[model samples]
Target chain A: MIIIGGTATNGIDENLSKIISVPLLKVEHKVFPDGESYIRIPQHITNQEILVVQSLYPPQDKHFVELLLILETLADMKNNKITAIVPYLAYSRQDRRFKEGEALSIKTILNAIARAGADVLIVIEPHKEEELSYFGKEVKIADPMPELAKEVSKKVEKPFVLAPDRGALERAKRLAEQLNAEYSYIEKERDRDTGEVRIKNLPELRLSGKDVIIVDDIISTGGTMIQATRAAYEHGARKVISVAVHSLFLDNAYEKLINSGVKEIVTTNTIPQDPSKVAVVDVSPAIARKI
Target chain B: MIIIGGTATNGIDENLSKIISVPLLKVEHKVFPDGESYIRIPQHITNQEILVVQSLYPPQDKHFVELLLILETLADMKNNKITAIVPYLAYSRQDRRFKEGEALSIKTILNAIARAGADVLIVIEPHKEEELSYFGKEVKIADPMPELAKEVSKKVEKPFVLAPDRGALERAKRLAEQLNAEYSYIEKERDRDTGEVRIKNLPELRLSGKDVIIVDDIISTGGTMIQATRAAYEHGARKVISVAVHSLFLDNAYEKLINSGVKEIVTTNTIPQDPSKVAVVDVSPAIARKI
Candidate 1:
């Protein structure tokens, strides 16, 4: 297998080395003044199975475009098989058309990626699993939340896993099961028009005097997490920690999380950061065997 | 005069009513899941002097693109004159070409807005004055920092304006003079490669037991303000406040500032928010005469 890593996937270089003997190739991206982008794969992979890893975080379009360019380049190079590992798929939120005349943009983007020459696609805890049909060949990765929670449990005594909202309760429960800890979720009501979220069932959780870890799949605005952490602290959680699979950490999310009573934040290498002091687990090894 | 308010400029609606008799118009934006955007004006704007008030805050590209699309649509509608009131211009940090072949992206974006049909462009204390040339427009709005400072003075007691960085010191001094308050600045060293900034001269300021207000043109990442607030608290500031002409509080910046010991974060209606407490001081009476 020949591995091609995008900018966000650069950290995977170390992890890939531990499991695979294949050489990891770096894809170069050059963005132009007119907002045009060009991508180049460094190694020759003709007739070879290729694994390309990229995270479609913010500046989402730009990164997604880069990935598209790479897939096109790889396909033109006649690579035998191409697998795209998009840890944070950018358009996952648009799984359906909420209004008339709006394109099923998520489907469109997926089709674009598939047409650009991806034989297989991998996404982590996508917003809606039904959308998996959008991808021609889908490979879903289990949430790394369980692994992260277990890791946190070893360091902190009396740790509990917290899901910021009900949508994430199952993931938190799984993590709790792994760590043999208690689990709970915040009941949230979000106003779609304004993007405002209100926590309703937060005060019901028994959080007093316990070390809590708020777990979620992604941290986009960090607004939800910040509010949840504050509520946890108010409910007497001695220290609140936040863990996520993909730290989209959009905007000034990291700073906001840090300031919002969160003692520490742990996330996977799904999204790269300078101060990412958490377990960097690779789904590639598990993925490689299946592919 | 016809008023066009962008999302951020919504706060200026009250002031516009007091100054002008014309009805205020709104530009609507629709963002697709695939990160594509569309914009439309509420009514016909043919041959009218249109002033668009928009603050380019977080999800920076989304807001910037929405502004651009509005400009394009208005131009297509043959508006007599178009003026963009951008209180907080995003991408101001990338004013210069740090690397060869790199786009002066900010300039390119400005030119795109101009091409989209802006007759005049108004900005509040742009990162650099010379950037005005990039707009290719006939009218420009320089620092309204002094006007904003006067407003702050009326609200606070013996407030001193402190520039978060040396680059902003001149504006701070201008505000200090207008408010009859002391002025100071922190020297900053920025990493050219990563766009990370570090404050070097923060410790030298003796803000102990004094009410300190940090003033700047724009707040994007909020890192500088966070540092300044921390340094102020360490130096014994009784209370720390922050004011900006354009609060392009990107991401979760507003929440971060509030959590970081900012007693109050006051910003002009340059950007609209539920938390926005200050509206732009209409220099329109003065500005209208010049145009």
Candidate 2:
């Protein structure tokens, strides 16, 4: 059995190999003069179990194409045991066709992965688990919430976990169990007429002197997290820390969160993170245990 | 039948519709704050022939993803008679695995397009006709050589067409026939010992002080065109003009061609072209005749 680290892994594949004690084969890649992606596997492995680790980081489309090429090349090599590990699946949120003629983006992406010949699939805390059904393979979930909770606890003493909405309540429950702290959720109610959202139920707990850590799966734009953080402060929480597995701080979201009185924004190495912009905690150990 | 222009079309789709006398429905697209590509098709027409036009320009992978989304979205809307008109087919050069453990990149791209549900595909002068086989469907080629010849002829009198190599002899023959000019090919002989190539046959035409034109399928990096231009000037030609269907002037190739004393560089609007960099000729009329 061998593992091949793809170009889009963001160094997480190296850590995954170390934790799992597996031989890792790295794929060499470069761009041609005409701006085409070129990838080549260095070592030849025949008829053996192979793990392909790649992430859909931005230049997300380029990374996604690399993953497709890697999987298809492995399949062409007669390696039917290829397992694709995409840390954060791109286009996962575009699963629904809310409008008249919108693209079923994740359906197309997942179908392409299957067509690329990945026998098994693994992803880290996808936006929704049901979206994985589009892959049409034996899919495994790699949860980084528990590990994130454990890591964020080191920054704040006695962290109280909170979920931004009901859909993310399970993530908060798992993290709260890891930290052994009280957890609650903000009930968000959207005005159907105006499409404006307001938090319905902020817990009336005596959270005056406690540190609040809001946990979720992905934090892009930081809209919901910022609102939840403000609500926690309104209830007299000492500090507000935002934690999630995938942190795509799009459009200066990290600065916006900090400006909105968020003490610290912590996330895993799912999407490539800037250390100075957001605090990163390792989630490779959690993935290693799953694989 | 109606046409829809994609974001990557670079005005070719609009010109195509105008030339073919078909209504054009432009696709609405934007990038989300999280760096995901979003596309929506407005003005749906059910059970009609839909022509979707896009190009594989730089940031090619993103454009490819958009193409897939458009095709699959049309398929989902029960539009089975969808025709995908991609001006330039990327990854076409990576058709063969020259080295061990290398990807047949074009094979993966073709297979993904097939899975994306494009019923018919029309491509402008591909790298090789056989590369289109990876698409596994009936593909129509839109040759712009004759049209480019007529356009380039307006600049010089009594042009002599020359092929860079034997593989591009057919392209030169077509263009030469259109201009009623004599054409010859440069024979490239590679040293089996060191893999160094040198031109064996430079045309020995009894032509002193006449315009020489070099035509090929694609002009990428402009290496062969520059070499052929110098050879033409060495043969006592007055001026050298370079022409091709697809112009991917990668990495200062246009400047290199100019520095080599090329009088004019002409190409079609297959890939996105800067007006100041190279002169673009219209090829939409040829495609309209085919369709």
Candidate 3:
């Protein structure tokens, strides 16, 4: 197998190579004077099984277009089989229309990827699993929960997994089981008329002097995590550690969470992050196991 | 008619509205912690003929996603008619397979845009006209040449239009006719063996003491324009001004062209530019005339 890494996934090729033996290809990219993407692949793969790795993270559109150009180039080269490994899939949040007139961007993005000659798509914990078929390709979803749980285990002793809300209970339960710790979820209530949200009944699990590990699939805006962290502190938690598969940390979410008394934040290297509260764990092993 | 503007097309909305007399809707957007695009269209656009103005230029992927979101939102909102006005269409260069097994990115992009509920796509001077049908929608192409010619008329005296190469002679001829100026094309020769390029024949039109306007649809990389500029200077042209519909001064192309002694560069407001070599002229009237 031949692995190709995009601009964001530069160092990741080494990680994937450690798990699976493959020759890695890197994209040489430059922005043209007219702002057009100029990409050149140095390696040649005539009839090899190709794996293209790129994360649709910040500067999402540029990375996405780069991926398309790479895929198109690979397709033109007549590669035998192609697998796209997108660690962080952008536009996954709009899986369904929340309200009338909402765009389901994920569906359109998936279709474009599939059309770009991606035979198989391997994503790590997309926002929703139900919409995986939207791409109309062979889809492989690698869950980073088990891997994230392993990272959480090393960070704290006397741990208790807390789901940010009821929706993320499954994630919390899985991580709790992996860590051999107690698991519980907070309740969230929204005022139907005013659209004001407030955290309802706290978890029944005793939180006093325990390392509270908040497990969620994604940490966008950090509103839910912030609220849960505040509740955890109020309920007598010793150290609040937030763990998620993807850390978008939009705006001042990380700063806000740190100020809200959260001790640590651990996330997978799905999205690019600067070293701070973000503890990026490798998910290559999980992807390699499936491959 | 309801006009909507994407992030890049904010100021252009007011210009478009001034011509069409419509309520302008702007998408308030932010990146989520998880890198998901959070877009909110403030205006109500139910059952109305909606025109969304977005230029898919640099950061092509993000702008493309925004356009998709807006289209999808309008679709979900059950808008009567959705018209997407993409000033600078990305992925237009790869309209056809240059080699076997090419992915044909433009076709996929068009399909995605069509699926996103863009009933009509209004583009200004896409790379090619033949592939417009690939969109499978009511595609209205608005040419900004006349408007660009009007801008050129004010910029120079004793103007003579010069196509950088033979292929763009048609465009140069059209613009020259519009400006009532003499037109000619330079001959370019590429060494098939060494892959080196050289300008062979200069234009027959005497370039001495006259404003020589180089015209083309696109000015990517500015290699051709730079070559043309050098040849014009060598042939004793008094002033050299480059004109194009899309000015994609990739990398140091802009600086290189300016250094090569081109007097001024004028491009339509199809793509964004800084206040330097590029002078952007508004083409809203052209689009509005069609609407």
Instruction: Put down candidate 2 lDDT per residue, A1-291, tens digits, no spaces.
Output: 788999888888899889989989999799898778998887677798888999997888999899888888888888459888889889999989788788889999989988898888889988999989999989999888667876687888868888889899888888888889888888889899999999885556556878999888888888999898888888888999888889888778888889888988889887888898778877788788788
Locate the minimum summed-lDDT window of 10 residues in model 1 chain A. Answer: A31-40
Q: Which is the leading candidate under DockQ?
A: 2
Candidate 2 chain B, poorest ten consecutive residues by summed lDDT: B200-209
On residues B92-197, what C-alpha lDDT tens digit does candidate 3 reach at each position? 8867765444446687578778877889999887777878888897999886778888888888989999998887888888899999999899998989999899
Q: Fnat per model, in the order given?
A: 0.01, 0.77, 0.38
Model 3 Cα lDDT, one tens digit per residue, A95-171 = 88675445677876787688777999999987778888998979998877778877788889899999988878888
Candidate 2, B1-291: lDDT as tens digits: 889898888788889888888999988799988778998898666798988898887788999999999888888878458888888888988988889889889999888887798877898888888989888887888888777877788888968888889899888898889899998888879999999887775556534677889988888899999888878877777898999888888778989999999988889887878878678887677678668
Error of 2 at B204 (Å): 3.4
RMSD of each: 16.0, 1.9, 3.9
Candidate 2 stretches with Cα past 4 Å from truth are A191-195, A201-206, A276-278, B190-196, B201-207
TM-score of 3: 0.84
What TM-score between 0 and 1 does chain B of candidate 2 receive? Answer: 0.95
Sorting all predicted structures by TM-score, with the top scorer first, yields 2, 3, 1
Cα deviation of B135, candidate 3, in Å: 3.9
